[model samples]
Target: MHDDGHGPGPARRQDQGAARHEHGHSHHRAHSPSHEGARAAGRLRHRLAHLLTPHSHESADRLDPALEASARGLRALWVSLAVLGATAAVQAVVVVLSGSVALLGDTVHNTADALTAVPLGIAFLLGRRAANRRFTYGYGRAEDLAGLAIVLTIGASAAFAGWTAFERLLSPRPVEHVPAVAVAALVGFAGNEWVARYRIRVGRSIGSAALVADGLHARTDGFTSLAVLAGAGGSALGWQAADPVVGLAITAAIALMLRDAAREVLRRVMDAVDPALVDRAERALSAVEGVHGVGELRLRWIGHRLRAEVAVVVDGEATVRQAHAIAVDAEHALLHAVPRLTAALVHADPAPVAGQADPHLALAHHARV
Candidate 1:
C-alpha cells in the first residue's frame, strides 16, 4: 500500500477533532431562537403546573376545610352550651320562685337543647377518626346517628311540655312573681336566638346539614320562649289559664320542630344529598377538555364531607393515556365544583355513536363519604 502523507495516528486525531467540532456546533444550535422558544415553552408549562396544583406549604397546619369545619363546630357547640346553660339556670330559678309550668317547660327544653350539642360534638369528633377495615367510610355516619338522637330528644321534650301544660290547665294554680317569669322568658329568647343564628350561619358555611337543623331547633325554641313571655303577660292580666295555654302552644310549636328535624334526619340517613351538587358535578365533567358527556353522577354525605362518583364520555379515538388524562381532569373539576367534596371517582368511557350502546350504562355507580 502506498504511504499517505497523514499517518494512522494523525488521521485518527483528525477524526476525533471533527467529531468534537460537530458536537460543539450542535450544542450551539441548541441555543438558537427556536430552541430558546421551546425552552421558554417548557418553563411556562412548569410554572403553569405549579399554579394548577395545590401547594403543600399552603396547609401549614394541615387543616383542611372539613377539619376546620369540625373544629369550628366543636367550638360552636361549647359556646352555645355555655350560653344555654346560663339561660336555663336563670329560667330554672324563676321556675322555682314563680311555679309557672310554662317557664319550667321552657327551661327544661333549653337545657335539653344545650345538652343535645353533646352528642353532636361527639359525632364531629368521631367523624375525624380515620376509616377502618370494617368502616371503609369512617365514622361520619355518627353525625346522622347524633341527628336521630337529637330528634328523639326533641320529641320527648314536646311530649313532656304537652303533658305538663295539660295537667296545669286541668288544675289551675296562681303563678307568683309573674314579672320574674317574664324576665327569664326574655332571657331564654335572647340566648336561644343568638345560638340559632350562630349555628345556622356556621353550619351552612361548613355544609353541615345536621348543625343547621340543630340551629333551626334552637330558633323554634326561641319562639317558644317568647310564648312563655306571653303567658306571663296573660297571667299578670289575671288570665290564669294563659300560662297553661301558652305551654300547650309551645308543645305544638315543638311538634312542628320535631317534624322538621325528623325530615332532615331521615333525608341524611337515606343519602338524599342536595340535587344542586349533582348538577354542579355534571356541569364540571361536561366542561373538561376531552369529556363529551357526563352520566350517572352520584353524590352523598358521610358525616359533613361530600363524595362523588362521575362517569365521563371521551372521544372513541382517544388512546388509553389520553382517556386517563381526561378522567383526571374531570376528577379535578368535580372536586372544585362541589363544596365540601373530599373524594371523587371518575370513570371514562367512549362516546357512543348512533345505535351503539353506551359503555357506562351497565357499570355500578356508588358514592359515599
Candidate 2:
C-alpha cells in the first residue's frame, strides 16, 4: 500500500482523535498552560538559532512555501545586483583616477559577481514553470546550471585579475590618488558585506544552494576590497609594487571562492542533502502509530523543496485497508517532521512471519536485472 500525502487520507482517524482528546480535556486542563508555554519557548529558541546560523533548509509553514521562497529569492537577487553594481561603478571611477591595479581587480570581480544574478534570476523564473511530459521533474535543475555558470564566471574573473596583476608586476607603475583609492575600497567593502549577508540569509531561508554560493562569492569580494586598502597604504608609502601584489592576492581570493562555490554547486547537482534530515525522517516515521519498522528512506531536492520516498513495516495480519491507513499516517508524519518537505511517498510492507516465504522473493531476479 502507498500514500502520496497530497490527498485527504484517513481524516476520520484525525477527527476521532480530536473527539477523544476533547472528552478527556478536563483531566489534563491543569497542565495545558505549562505545556503550551514550553512549546512556545522552544519555538523561540529555534528561531533565534536559525537567525544566528542559518541552514540550507529551515522549517516553513506556508501553504506553498516553494512559491514564496522563489519570490523571495528573486527579490534578493535583484536588490543585490543593484547594490553591487553601484559599488563596482564607484570603484571603477576610482580605479581610473588612481590607476591602482588592486582596485581595478576588485572592481572587475564585483562587476562579475553582480552580473551572476542575471543567470540566477533566469533560473528562478524557469523554476516556476509547471512540469511537462518530457521534463517530469520540472525545471528546478536550471538553478544548478545557473550555479555552474556562476562558478565559471568566478573562474574567468580570477584569471583576468591574475593576468592583469602579473602584467602590472612586470611593468611597475605609480598608483596616484591614493586617498581616493582608500575611500573607494572602503565603500566596496561596505556594499559587498551588506549584499553578502542579505543574499546568504535569503538563500538559506529558501534553500537555494546557488544563491548561497553567490553570497559567499560576494563575501570574498568584500575582503578583497579591504586588501585594496592595504595596497593604497603601501602606495602612499612609496611602495610601487604593492598595488600589483595586492591585485594578485585578490585573484587568489577569487580562486578560492571559485573552488568553494564549485563544490557547493556540484554537491547540489549530485542530489546531496544533510544527513541529519534523513535521521529526522527516520525518527518521525518510527514514531507514527502502527509503524512496526522503518525501511529504506530517501530524500532529494527538487528545487528548494524536498521529496521523500520511504518504506514502512506494519503487521502482516493487518487488512489492506489498515496497512494503507498506516502508510498515510507515516506520510503525514514525514511531511510534518522534515523541513522544506513538500511531498512524501510512503510504502507499507508486511512484516515477516515465521515459516512464510519472503514476499519480495519472487521479484529478487528482477531486482538483479
Per-candidate TM-scores read 0.82, 0.83
Best by TM-score: 2
Candidates in order have lDDT scores of 0.80, 0.83
**What are the RMSDs of all candidates, in order?**
15.5, 9.6
Tens-place lDDT digits, model 2, residues 1-369: 121222234565444433421212122212246644764675577579769986432222333467778999999999999999999999999998988889999999999999999999999998877667787667888999999999999999999999999999999999999999999999999999999999999999989999999999999999999999999999999999999999999999998888999999999999999999999999999987678899888899877778898878876655455556567667767766988877676766777889978877867988854
User: What is residue 219's positional error in candidate 2, in angstroms?
Assistant: 0.6
Q: Candidate 1: which stretches are off by over 4 Å? A: 1-63, 353-369
Model 2 sits at a Cα RMSD from the real structure of 9.6
Model 1 clash pairs are none
For residues 132-218, write the lDDT of model 1, one tens digit per residue: 678776788999999998999999999998999999999989899998998999999999999999999988888777888899999
